[model samples]
Target: MQNDLFYQELDQFNLFSEFAEPQHYQPVPNDWFVVITDVVNSTQAIQDGRYRQVNALGVASIVAIMNSIKPLKVPYIFGGDGASVCVPSSVLQQVKQALQATVILAKQQFSLEIRAGVVPVSDIRQLGKDIRVAKFQPKDHFSQAMFDGNGLSAADSLIKQANSQYLIEPVESDSLDNNDLFEGFECRWNEIPSRSKEHIALLVQALPNEQFSSDQIYQIVLMAINGCYGDELAYHPITPKQMSLSSKVADLQNEAKIRSGFVGKLTKYKYIAKLKLLRHVGNYLMKNKVKTDATEWGGYKQRLVENTDFQKFDDMLRMVISGNEEQRVQLENKLKQLQQSGLLAYGIHSAPSALITCMVNDYNHDHVHFLDTTRGGYAMAAKQLKSQLATLKSVE
Candidate 1:
């Protein structure tokens, strides 16, 4: 089994429906590890109107790990309030140290508690469930990881337990040397206004049934969403016209705010100043259609839209779509009918706008964007899904 190249070696598929198929997924190598990080009380934080901070912290975790394991490609998924990364054993220690630093950074900066954990693929297999992974490439320059089977869900359950052995606790520290940790992470763009009546964040998990396979059930759910909201181009949460860079000082200082204590105040101020200058330059370049060796500023917004993880699958179907109340209700009715027939459990949340957090290592390529709803995003939707799952368990 290849260690570092496990994910890089997988075959890539284009159709989202093919992601639901078992044949496309390969069992994760036993030597790999799945690192999970999530904010505690995230729903309350979102209710408190700190969804942007939560989203940033989640992206911070990913950036930290990716930067630590430099030159290594891994499979990962970005949940709204957290992220999950799978790395080979060779870089597990570096990943852990990065996560620990992130834990300390989140607490000191945002007053948010982040729980980090590590679960080995070998252990997931011991539970009789495997972490089967596949690569989904919607465009030539980008690809997203898709996970199937119940291994990731089982690993999540173990980590969220009261006394999870896999938990990575934070060390006591007023400041961690983390200025270099979250290198490419940024959240300077304004919240994307919904083009439709509202933007909806949806989570759906297909249940095991004797009549129809899980893949078939998910296909039904996808059809329901596309049928009601049209297709990806129609319902995608972000568009070129709706994208705007924030001119507010506070908005530009967003990263610097969380970056406090990690560096001296003077350094933080300089960083903020640099961000302001960069934003101005970016605006001018993009507006004037300037062409640089790294990126064509004019088409960057469209590329960013194309590269977003707006719709993804990681043991669950997660998406953010633009729709009206009527479309939402129609989709809900279809999901309800399917759930009543013992096909799936779903959760949905809606808000006026969608949130975006980005990681940009390069201008032309090597950049990926994350999306969520402003009000609650995936964490709240997952909470609803958990409630339905508990109820389903009670009746069974």
Candidate 2:
């Protein structure tokens, strides 16, 4: 059977406002598979000051699967502690091996447990759920994938179940030949401090009900958010002026560890040293606005900010915004009204700064920045959201 080009052939919509509209999305092909990867005990890891590691693992999952299936563009979403990707059946086994390799790499290098799984889209539909996806291009240089419908949520739930049939357990291996598997995965940027009083990492999930659809509820929430913080990009969590390359050994070593993947001391050191030098050179180029043949250093930061996935949707609305107390309060008050009205459940985690993880295949173009708050961004908000969901379930 020929692999479906559903995602590759789909048209992209430009406006973020249109993301909540149901008409913009199409159902994921039933023959394709949903691949998910998540860090176990991530909330505890974040509390232990390991959010950077958590973010890297999430991006690592995407990088590995993407590199393995090169030239075949698919839809994916990067959560702070994990990631989800939809792939054609043609590469299911290949993709699963990459995921297993990623699982091995995570445990060996980071001492982190990654739960990886694959489920057929047909199964999700069999259970009366669906995965609909759309392409969102906030900037011409980058296209962010957006997911609606409960199919992804169902996949996550299924994968997390104990002894579930879908789980992918890594074979016992001391090391994987993974130096080339995680290409283009980089995390050299220093955390971006909030331009306003605080950075809010928020998640809003609409409830299922007969009165109104999830799309209608999300549209109201988006409008309320815009009302609190104007439609301009000023409220963006990461700004060009606030962005700078990190020189920290710890930051450099995170990428080195993933790319090196349980290699000998000499190889690991070489990886770290190479990254250190790259960081130094990047600092020089960007600080002096040196334009190279590959990238326009002067405009790269602006483009990075424009392309950051600070706001996205995948069955739920996820965002990282910089706003003052007044704006935060206004937004929360509006959210409170929505919750009281039984329209949606929400959670927000406020922090001093936001974190940026990059998957850059090219310096000129082809890069997407993943955003999260420094301490327990999406993971923490998700915890709170889960509690609220329970409360709503009880009342329902």
Q: lDDT: which candidate is best?
A: 2
What is the lDDT for 100 in model 1?
Answer: 87
Model 2, 1-396: lDDT tens digits are 444688988889998878888788999888999998999999999999999999999999999999988978999999899999999999888798789889988888889999999999999999999999999987778898999878998999999888999999787665455666788898889988998878999999998589988878988998899999887576888778898888788987788888877576677788878877887887788789998888988778888888789989998999998998899899999999998898899998899999999988888778888999999799999998899989977976
Error of 2 at 227 (Å): 2.0
Q: What is the lDDT of candidate 1?
A: 0.87
Candidate 2 segments whose C-alpha is farther than 4 A from its true place: 1-3, 174-176
- On residues 318-353, what C-alpha lDDT tens digit does candidate 1 reach at each position? 999998999999999999999888889999999999
TM-scores for candidates 1 onward, in order: 0.96, 0.96
What is the C-alpha local distance difference test score of candidate 2? 0.88
Clashes of 1: 0
